[model samples]
Target: MITRTVVMRAVRTVVFTLALPCLLVAVWWVASDSSTSVYAPPLRTILSRFDDVWTADRIRGDVVPSLLRLAAGYASAAVAGVVLGVGIGLSRTARAVCEPALEFLRAVPPPVLVPVIMLFAGIGDTMKIAVIASGCVWPVLLNTVAGVRAVDPVATETARAYGVRGAAWLRSLVLPSASPQIFTGLRQALSIGVILMVISEMFAASNGLGYAVVQFQRGFAIPEMWTGILVLGLLGVVLALLFTLVERRALAWYHRSRGARRKAGSGGA
Candidate 1:
């Protein structure tokens, strides 16, 4: 099963994955060695401090809470978005009634809502979660609606003709057709979720990665701040990789279908 093409592709992927990061780190290591800048501490200094600052004790206080808030907010958004999107996509009346409100709310930048949320939710973890959820919902909701609405008319008609109805119809036809777009929305929402998590924490919080980063910066602990930044960047990468794996698993059928189509088109040509 391991063909030359597959082997080559794997090699390419590994190289592509490691190349940029290795190059960047090497460059930083070189460039920062001679730097006397107070803010831009040497990469070696950052790495040394990174080890100390991101230890288990610090992670328990900072990283865990941030990750938990992110998960809660993202999960809440995903559920609400998919449900509301389905409702809106299925019913013209619902779309007509809800679209304007959705548009209005989506227009308001997520960060602006942090203060409002804090005022009501009182600067607690709840407020941060709410702020993040508010931001994350829009992409999933809008994409789901678009995807559902864009389902092939012929497919819908065929299902109707076959006496398919209600939940069965949705399960059999709508969801499969709309899944790719829904996944796209989820991907967008994931990044937005991270951004909102940081914003909410930075805006108001006694604990969190963002809070710790700001505290470090305020105290002029530049290397510690860099470690926070580095940790966040690494977290984003890990989250993205995790999402990609989940997406591939969830949309395996979709990928197979696309591959089949490509083969068909190639053979026809």
Candidate 2:
């Protein structure tokens, strides 16, 4: 099952993926080595402080809370988006009624609504979670609606003919057909969720990555602030990798089907 060619390809993929980031880090290392500015410390200084600043205690008090909120908000948004999306996608009357309200709400930026949400949800984990969910839900909801609408008409008819009505029809045909688009929405929502997580935490929070970063900045701890930012970036990359793993597993069939179709088309040509 495994071959030298496969191993080589995997190595090449890893190299290409890392090349730009590695290059950028190298450039920064060289550029910042001679820096004497208090605001912009050397990359070496930042790296040296990284371990000390982001110790286990700091991680537990800051990073864990942020991640927990992100997970909770993102999960809730995904669930709500899919459910409402499917319902609205299947009904012309519901779509028409909801379209205007959806448009109006989505147009308002999530950050601007933070104070309003704070008024209702208060200055706690609830507010932060709500903020993240508010921003993340739009992309997932809109994409799901579009994906459901784009399901193959022939497949829908076949399902109906086979007495696969209601939930059976949706489970067997609609959901699978729309999954690719739904995953696209999910990818977009993930980035938004991360951003909103930080933004929400920057306000009225004592123990979170964003709050820590802000405090470091205010206290003129530039190196520690930079480390905080670096940690956030690393966290985002880790979350993205996790999401990719899930997507690949979930969409393996869809990917295989597309590959088959492409091969068939090429052969015909």
Candidate 3:
């Protein structure tokens, strides 16, 4: 069964993990054959560049800072999104005051804000993190609101009957119900985070996979450029799979308890 799951996962994984580069290679080979002399570097050349890209100097100088920026941005978005979502879901007054403004804010494209954000934040990690956070926070915030609001009122009443009322009541009754949606949001946000990280790096940074790619492209080092892009794409796939695993583990109890309840209900009926 685990093998089956792994195999199924391979299909999705390979598209990101393998197929893209394979496709790039096929494109390169074809284009190289055509006479795009300067533009087309074939598969072997790009493949060879991966070693240099992975060198300790490259890793330390570029990859560490990129990962740090992503972590800070993603973590900030997750925390703020979850907190504000919970607040919106739990309190009508707060929701009324905050939700519309948030919706408006979310509607504005993240890249558009980069120029404005950079004015205050400058072209550094701060601006990158802020841009990433802004881009990712919306999906998580909305998903969390949906999750909490969708919890059954009957369940809340049951909790109340057992004296589970107020904030404590919510912690016992609503949050568990909302956990799945929260995780779903986190997964979606993580993907968005990766995209934004790359975009931010491309626009303003001195280091990162995007920076490496841009630098190589400018210098006409086509293979190195491709290598940087490939590494970034791989990083995205790895992070997505890791988040999915975390989601499955976090919601395992919820799924089991739900299945058991449904089975018991069916027997009684």
Which one wins on lDDT? 2
lDDT of each: 0.94, 0.95, 0.84
Question: Candidate 1 on 119-179: residue-level lDDT in tens?
Answer: 8999899999999899999999999999999999999999999999899999999988998
Where model 1 places Cα greater than 4 Å from the true spot, the runs are none
In every candidate, how many clashes are there? 0, 0, 0
Instruction: Kindly indicate the candidate among 1 and 2 with the higher lDDT.
Output: 2
TM-score of each: 0.96, 0.98, 0.83
Q: Give the C-alpha lDDT of model 3.
A: 0.84
In model 1, the Cα lDDT at residue 90 comes to 91
Q: Quantify how close model 2 is to the true structure by its C-alpha RMSD in Å.
A: 0.9
| Residue 48, model 2: Cα distance from true site in angstroms | 0.6
Deviating ranges (above 4 Å) for candidate 3: 1-37, 257-269
